[model samples]
Target: MKIRVTGAFLFNVLCTISYTCCGETVGKRPPHIVMIIADDMGSNDLSYRGLDQITTANLDAMGFNGIIFNRHYTEPICTPSRAALLTGQYPIRLGLQGEPISAGEDRHLPPDVQTLPQLLKELGYTTHLVGKWHLGTARREDIPKGRGFDTHYGYWNGYIGYFDYETKSAMTITSEVYEGFDMKENFVDAWKDKGIYATHIFTEKALDIIDAQNKDIPMFLMVGHLAVHTGKNGMVEVADEKTMNNTYGYIADLERRRYVDALMNLDDSVGRIVEKLQQRDLLQNSVVIFMSDNGAQIRGIFHNGGSNYPLRGEKFSHHDGGIKNAALLYSPLLEKKNYIHDHLIHITDWLPTLYSLAGGNITSLKKTDGVDQWLSISQNKPSKRKNILINIDEVKLYSGVIGYGGRYKLLNGTIQSGFYDSFTGEPQSSNKMDYDIAAILNSRVNKAIKKSKVPGKHLDEALIRNLRKSSSAIRNNSKCNRGTEKYEICHHFCLFDLWTDPCETENLIRQKSKDDIVLNLKNQLAEFWNEVSPQTNKPVDINSDPAKYNGTWCTWLDDEFCIKIKTNNQNKNCNENNRSTSSIPVLKL
Candidate 1:
């Protein structure tokens, strides 16, 4: 006997089954998320990226076993990139596209903006932040605790001394330089941990959070490391004497050696975090993301002896060296692993992508400029993003602007008069030893196979190694017509095919066939400029001086509020005695 069912009836039956399965899946716990951000790290800083001087064994292992983001982009500075990461929106929309939020500046991420931690908390996950919180501190409501995290264990300023934990700030109001301790633990001064190195301290705190997390409840932890960034007085803080003396003696440049020491310490932190997750039996259900905030400051303010060699421009320019960052994602959830993702990815995409991965409805994220790239990343699908508005800050010194669409990139104006638009770093031949790519690949691949859930599956180590080498070759390949000429400031406009000339060595403005591409990019920039909000930067408030608060950077405005209220009450009493109630001023509070 043959039976035929109506199409509508069959479809209704399938829909009912799908709904039932979805309901059951929603009751299960989501994956744990651990995001680690490095400060002022360079594109070529990692050994896997062809920097022969430094050895990042742990980072290389993660890259080899996970997905290496070859074309990831971030803001050219600290605060903007961070803001974009947490809010899933362009910094221009949030008034955070200007300079970083300096010490005592009355600038911060807008209070009404929904942050990543806040969203994660709503999804029944515990959230913690354990590093730099350069977002804002003008009000008690601007710190990480107020923003969404359950706890914060780090500094509130941009950068601080590695050991002393002191931040030096030049007051915009008084023009006096003030230095004070800046470490904090959940809104209180963390004075006891002053002598400890920041990388070690932050790592310990992250591990503690992971260990204490409830297995039934998912966790979200963000480790914002202060390593690789310049410390007090613009110096790269090195590790202890014994470790430095035992290793990194091959490099003659003292500054570069110090940077390598700091970087290795950061790598150790990564390895420890992964090992801890494995020991806790959380490795199978955890997703780890590692990224740098922006490119290194090689030759400008806060120069850290870091390098973004082979890519033009440094920390503040609108070039690849400034915005193209080092990033990778590792997780058991990925269907495809041990490959490079060359698609365009912006920092803003993290919020929405992670939210979707946590089983949240994408429609809930309102007015977000970021596209959900979870499927693109996990399943190896094409990226949904077509164009990226890098940045347009009219308030900055150089009025720098950049717009990227398709294979074409358009730039207008420049940063620091394009002084950093040249390759700058320690020479590639500084070290006599060559990097052993095969050995690193083989080690990582074997470890990954041991931990694999699939039975009898093997990774082609040679193919993976070739993938890494080819990706590096493509990134460093430069086909430019101009030889030995600096990429000068683009006072008006400049156009280049980034696909062919990643170095920005050739200007294609005069080519008639490319006129349409230039016009389209300019239009995109104009559209972005139309929607930009006024920059939120404010002059440094002298009242924020730590001298008034026992040599610690506290929420000074909170104390100021109490003082103002007391004075207002006194004035009100005096006015009442004089029979002039209307003279009493009403405080806004």
Candidate 2:
């Protein structure tokens, strides 16, 4: 027997032989992951997604060339959605499910949660984040740099002025601007005061990171664009004048025109980054995914001017318009391109999927609410995701749970019919799914799943158990009603099938012989509440820490009240409010 070296010894010998004989080393390099998230972008914002008013050529191309997620869902707001994305868990589990991270509020992603960057870092990937980090900024270990990103350059709050880099706070009584590197290193006066539009500045910084990357190491970049979200003064504070004038020359309304201009600039940002990747010879080796944090602001809130027509509610509601977002995934590793995936994908799925794509084993990670659908996604196979527990939060004025299983979905306590079919770009009708659509998508995913050599079903038992519990408790308690006493079950509960009627025009709760379905959904909703509700934490008391706001009140000498200082030049006389006698200039509300 020729020495009979096998098993571990044989594997080591084969590895040595491959390294010596084959010029290539350590298998294939992991693909670089680029996750581009847009703030307040709607499902129909892109021309390809049925937007006749706006033109998003680059975004359209990415969708057309990549995989389109017709039914991808995110949290109804910004902070919770981001938390879900990073932690691969529902925001409720992270205690950040309630509200957005407001200025100076001492709350953040819990330190125990394993983030995407932290997982990728173990795989030897260099991680960098550019743009909105609204997850948290309360403690020193709560920010992006402290979490996992090797380098972070952006604001930690929700919406900031695109040009001024400031956000108006009722608590602060002034618009505070934050621009800096790691918050831990420099929390005070770290602004650059470049006066450039926020979108452009963020783009340049992203390019710099990409250009400076070492080719040997795989990279993961998260570019959170602050475009489309209204600025401090409203939506009119900033927009590329040249692009705005050129694109919407015929639009009469200034605000509407400005909104369109901001959208066009957002599209351009997408194109520029793709172009940069192409020029760097990294496009083919990169995986690019684009999605919105939540639905668009269609109701003119904060002077917003985007539309989510045909879909129901705006950003902060339980309607599909609020949770169902515009999303696409592109990569050379994917066998299927120019396709629409109708499978239910939640915001939490990205972390596990991406971590696996970067050569991580999903089974080795901390128990997450996400499932590894890499095989199903990359190859265009039928997604293994059968049910999705959207969210249940009592934090907002409109609070309820949304759950989907098979062709049926329930919103709150009322049940309706119909589901939005992304492939046909319309709502599914009757009790049947479009076979032609299924065939087209399934064939591609099946092939990819086969080639991946990984099992399509990567659901963890713990996650499944949790989901099963949540799905069974939808309308169990009357007190759980989102502060509304209208409904008998849970006061604010409304249910819809989403398969037969996508617009939620009819309620099937009082229908004939649907008690079993209604009871199961109620249990599901109740389970979510019982598990996630207790995790929600209260916001930190900003009044307890006055030192954090020192010198950060008025950085600009030309603010509305600052005009008094320029003419008077009396520094000591500026403390009119007596809020702080420390001599820091305060903006009188």
Candidate 3:
């Protein structure tokens, strides 16, 4: 990997921040980018986006002034989208096609992949991450500090008992007893070991990172808050049993209100981070982007109420509600208004865009999977982003046979996690045209996946075969899948025509003539499949028995890896008498 540095040209490292464009020579002041991401703020829940119930004043103000992208797309889940956002390519492209992060493994992003933080770090900017890092965990090497981030302060795993904050940094890692992550470093241990609420501490660390810096270079701070992602321990009652207090409308989701309270507090942290920048006279020269990793977790209908209302679907499914997050970008470089860009942009595109905005030499870097789109956003240019995004269970279907093109998305036959238009409030649905499109989206995605394939691992094709083995009498005939697939409830393959029917009420799978659309899409899918043949490498089959695909079996946290626990721990099973029993459902791709 050749290191290219032409830093003196194209960027003026000395201009003070400004308010309003004021013809501010942005090129001279190359803005400091601060990407703030909320864990699970819903698509229609933010006040700026037209949600009446919740008030995201900070985000709304940012949207009111800067550019609000109306058509942002992710994997409708956490880990994949976050990976895609940082990589500037499809999560599938990088083998991160399933779940938020890997189950029971310290699944670091592949070493060869391009990461936004790494790119910025190489470009001479101080990079930092503070908050949930569901992307990878379980090992010291898998921590964020190792992944281009110069500093980090947050939990390595998903959750902890009441009142806790844990941290791992480039210099030191404070360990606590956590069930999922660094068992040595629990928030309670952080609370017990070092009185800190992970959120507030991270905020302070982020602010401190900004303050303790000298004027040697600019900064790129990514505050990926983990609040609101959990059911409600921070703001409201979270556990079902805790809802006995019964103060809110729906008491079952106490975890949700606590989640909201935690979120509200996080907003204050955002305000503080912004204020620090302003105080340093850098806000004017900084670009602030706020959004969630994915849609709301559907704990209870209104528990967290991470509303995807006008859109459809929730976490775990690839519906609009799941993938289309509410995003706002603020910069003096951008105009002040409720400007919305409906162009289709996914998380990965940010890789190149961030580089372009930072004026980095991306062309000479082999790890990048992004496209520079700053000029496009500033000039209102059309999107040239990928048309398709596909993730074959446990495999990233990007590049080779499964890459993205334009105006299309491809996917394996695993289509239950759907796509739709719940982006706005609830739909009125007289628009039969959109409904018509909704009916065909699944087939379209499947077709897209089939056509996007160019070469490399053929795990997706094998996973598709495994799905057909669910009802088989014996497990031996199933695809030689190394692990069992995870299955959610009746999260059936759904469709919606955002161009016409956004509600996604009228399912098109049963439609008689829908076969034509399905067939057309399947053919397109085949094109991509042949394009990226797993045969090139003679990829060894993991499963030869299509009948052995036992994804329906349950386990903790909807993670497929947990399924093997039952088989592995034949002596130890979920028992009421024993406390080792876990309630989390195993979800496999």
- Model 1, 36-111: lDDT tens per residue? 9999998888877767776577787777677889888899899999999999999999999998998878889999
lDDT score of model 1?
A: 0.77
Q: Which stretches of model 1 miss by more than 4 angstroms? A: 1-28, 397-406, 425-430, 437-464, 475-485, 560-589
Which candidate has the top score in lDDT? Answer: 1
TM-score of each: 0.87, 0.74, 0.64
Q: How many residue pairs in model 3 have overlapping backbones? A: 97
Candidates ranked by TM-score:
1, 2, 3
Better of 1 and 2 by TM-score: 1
Which runs of model 3 end up more than 4 angstroms from their true locations? 1-25, 102-104, 165-195, 231-256, 300-304, 335-337, 367-369, 394-495, 506-589
- CA lDDT scores, all candidates in order: 0.77, 0.62, 0.50
Worst 10 residues of 3 by lDDT: 544-553
Name model 2 segments beyond 4 Å from true: 1-27, 172-190, 300-303, 395-406, 413-491, 533-540, 543-550, 553-589
In terms of lDDT, which candidate is stronger, 2 or 3?
A: 2
Q: Could you tell me the TM-score of candidate 3?
A: 0.64
Q: With candidate 2 superimposed using the best TM-score fit, by how many Å does residue 413's alpha carbon deviate from the native? A: 7.1
